[model samples]
Target: MNRNTFVPVNEPLLKGNEEKYLLECIRTGWISSEGPFIKQFEEQLAARVGRKYGVAVSNGSVALDASVAALGIGAGDEVILPAFTIISCAAAIVRSGAVPVVVDCDPVTWNMDVAQVEARITPRTKAIMVVHIFGLPVDMKPMLALAHRYGLKVIEDAAEMHGQTYAGKPCGSFGDISTFSFYPNKHITTGEGGMIMTDDPALAEKCRSLRNLCFKPEQRFVHDELGWNFRMTNMQAALGVAQLEQLDKFVQIKRRMGARYTSLLAGIPGIQLPLPRTDFADNIYWVYGLVLADSVPFDAKEAMTRLAKLGIGTRPYFWPMHEQPVFRKMGLFAGESYPVAERIARRGFYVPSGLALTDGQMEQVAEAMRKVFQ
Candidate 1:
């Protein structure tokens, strides 16, 4: 093995019509938010996800913020979410003047424990924020049932789940308002962008209004409500349009990468690989993660340090929301403990699993892992 060969944690593949669309944008001077690619990208993504409308936003985080506000969930409302997800989930709720009620995740899937959600629900619970963690979809059948029974809204965060499905239904199709991210590391990259999907025309309109500063169509300068300037630029949409065209191919490549890594790293001691498939959906290998066994002498930070010295890039798992200092200082999740989330946060980290990763690079990563654990 070449000790100097470096493998990054993720890299975007842009072999499609990205250049053509971007050049078109430049040629036509449709470079701002008013470009044609914006609508084209939004409509195409909405159709692919089985939704009636899509609102392109600046990025995924604001997409959540817009979705929360559009749903009319504000002060005194409670949104149930997982403790194992990114801070963006809780941040949106907190920013909206709503309380985020968190539930523990399943140890195996690392998705919100649907079983635990029911126990945490109170009279103020207004919505269930279902985030599809990693590549696996949260068991949505039961989640949908719970939402139906409780009369609570569902906000699906399918940020890492492009072209993935749950129980044969599209992931973005499950929630009343679903959101997606097009960050460079996602299955499809648009540099930095996001989309909000919904079947209700009214909700779709609200998302659009919210993203563009709540400007009235009839009177551009007049604003009746406060909203953020979260519109996705035409240049970003050009990338999205081209990238969306290659989604099916990208998904296939991701699954193959995951399969190859699993085959290569299969019996390595002291590490737990991702569950390849759930009952409802196969793992998309958004990023190939590994959790150290309890017997391992070191935690994920040390593991990452070792891998970095070996010229392999890795990233630690999300720190559980309850343990975050910002939340603690805000008097949230006081005295809470989620053992599974805590353990994973300390023990889990993902290796190189980019769309642009070659088979040879993956083999090198596997060799690096062998060296690290030996």
Candidate 2:
């Protein structure tokens, strides 16, 4: 490895028709929220995920917020979800004046523990927000069963699992409402954008209204309800359309990259490689992560620091939300413990798994690990 060179954790691939579509928007002056590209991107992406309608939003966090709002999840409603996930999920629940009931993840898949989900349900529980983490679908069958049995809405956070499926169905297909993010690090990106999708037309319209500041279509500047400005721009949707066109190719590339990393790092001592395949399918390594085994004297933070010194970039897993200071200050999840999540958060993190990453870089990264262990 060159001492002067740094290998980043992720680099988004954008070698499609992004420029062509983007230029069209520029020429036509269709740069704002209402444009053909927005609807086209929304419809195309929604169909790909087997949903009837898609509403473009400003960002992923608001996608979640719009979903919560569309479902009428408010004041005194309780939403159950995994503790080991991005803060956007919990924040959406909190913002809607709903309580987020946190649960641990399965030790193997690192998705939510479906078994634990049932236990968290109560008379006030109104929804289950399932986040398909690290590009793997949560085992949705059980989650769906519980949702049906309890009459609770299911919101699929398919932001990470684009082009991924569960039991031969789309990741976004099972939930009543689903959301996706187009952040640069995702499988596909619009620089910064998001979408909310659903089979229910009413929910879809409600999400659209919430995304657009609740403007009454019949009159201008007349509103009955408060809403945020979460409308995605036409330029972003143009980029998204281009990205979506190449999403299948990107998924294949990601799997290839993940397999190469697994093969190279197989049986590395003191660190446990991410499972090559899970019960669902080949573990699509969003970032090629390694968990320091209990036998190791050091933790993931120390390992990351060592790798950084070697000019290799890495990112740690999400710290369990139940342990967050902000949530604690709010008196939420007080004294709650999710042991599996806590363990992985301390030991797990990913190396370079970017679509733009090369095989040669993986070799260097694996070699750097050998040096770190020594």
Most accurate candidate by lDDT: 1
Encode model 2's per-residue lDDT on 1-374: one tens digit a residue. 67437888888887899989999999999999988999999999989999999999988999999899889999999999999999999999998999999999977678899988888899999999999888577888888999999999999998888888887787778879999999988887998999998999999888888888898999869999888899999999999999999988998999998888878877678877666776666666666667788899989999999999988999999999899899999999988999999999999988988889987788889899889885
Summarize candidate 1's per-residue lDDT along 242-276 as a digit string, tens digits: 99999999999999999999999998999999999
Instruction: Give per-residue lDDT, candidate 1, residue 211.
Output: 92
Candidate 2 wrong stretches, greater than 4 Å: 1-4
- Model 2, global lDDT: 0.88
TM-score of each candidate?
A: 0.98, 0.97
Give every collision pair in model 1: none
Query: Model 1: number of clashes?
Result: 0
TM-score of 1: 0.98
- Which ten contiguous residues of candidate 2 have the minimum total lDDT? 278-287
